[model samples]
Target: MPPHVLAATRALNWLELVTETMRTALEALAAAAPEWLIAHVDEEWFERYARRADDYRLPDGDTARTAFAVTVGRDGIALLQAL
Candidate 1:
């Protein structure tokens, strides 16, 4: 296959993985903290996250990647605290 095709395939796979992971996380959250999920998470929030995940790209450099990871970590922590 051509390089562009290979790259597109990988990106699609990554998106699928992210989407599936988010779905699983949402399921677990709904099961474990239904009240919290209902209070904090809405359909719009899910749609926004899904859109962002679909558009997500890896950071270009190490510093950018680290910052991205840190931001994601902080978001996870905030969600946990909310729960």
Candidate 2:
């Protein structure tokens, strides 16, 4: 396959992985921290998160991907700390 085709395939695979991981994380979060999710996470927030996860794309480059991961990690930590 051409380079562009290969790249696109890889991106699609990454997106699928991210989507599944997000779904699993959401399920675990709901089960493990139902009270926290209920108090802090509104319905709108859940809808927005679901949409984003369903349509998520991998960041364009290594630096962007790293930044995205770091931001997510920080956000998760902040949420946990708020509990």
Candidate 3:
């Protein structure tokens, strides 16, 4: 049997809404500085991009990915390839 990779597309903001851990972090960011990405995240790699910031809230418009999360933290985006 092979490991399964469940490709789930989500808006970058959606990650902060739907995922509890993310919400906590992002909410703090929103409260403290509504214009910057928060700590607990590797902002160096993951870019915070939005077409309209608020308008790009729909997950349906995200690019399709044939990958899945590993230890999805606010720090990284890991896709399982072969393990």
Candidate 4:
């Protein structure tokens, strides 16, 4: 498989794990903040770059392709140890 595909697959797998583990909590969050569940991306930019576009740019120059968005509350943090 291509590198991008592999990366996406890994991300999706991790997403599945997260959603499964926190189904109840996620459901409540979805009810309270539905917008948080929406995926973040620039449609126009995505049209040009497709999956090749980096969704986020780090201060250190690294880039990230986020499969989706998850907005935990202001003081909330979600961390995945391994995926």
CA-lDDT, candidates in order: 0.59, 0.60, 0.37, 0.37
**Candidate structures ordered by lDDT, highest first:** 2, 1, 4, 3
State which candidate has the highest lDDT: 2
Of candidates 3 and 1, the better by TM-score: 1
Residue 2 displacement (Å), model 4 = 0.8
In the range 5-74, model 3's lDDT, one tens digit per residue, is: 2333243444544334434545556677655544344454233322223433333333421121122332
20-62 per-residue lDDT for model 1 (tens digits): 5555676788789887787876555454344334334545554
Cα lDDT tens digits for candidate 4, 22-83: 44444455577656543322234223222221323211211322323342111124322110
Which ten contiguous residues of candidate 2 have the minimum total lDDT? 47-56
Model 3 global lDDT (CA atoms, 0 to 1): 0.37
Q: Write the per-residue lDDT of candidate 2 for residues 1-83, one digit (tens) a residue.
A: 89998986676566546545654666678899878777875454365346444324546765776576565555456555755
Poorest stretch of ten by lDDT in candidate 4: 74-83
Decoy 2 TM-score against native: 0.50
TM-score of each: 0.54, 0.50, 0.28, 0.33
Best model per TM-score: 1
lDDT of 3 at 72: 39
Q: List the residue pairs that clash in candidate 1.
A: none
Worst 10 residues of 3 by lDDT: 74-83
lDDT value for candidate 2? 0.60
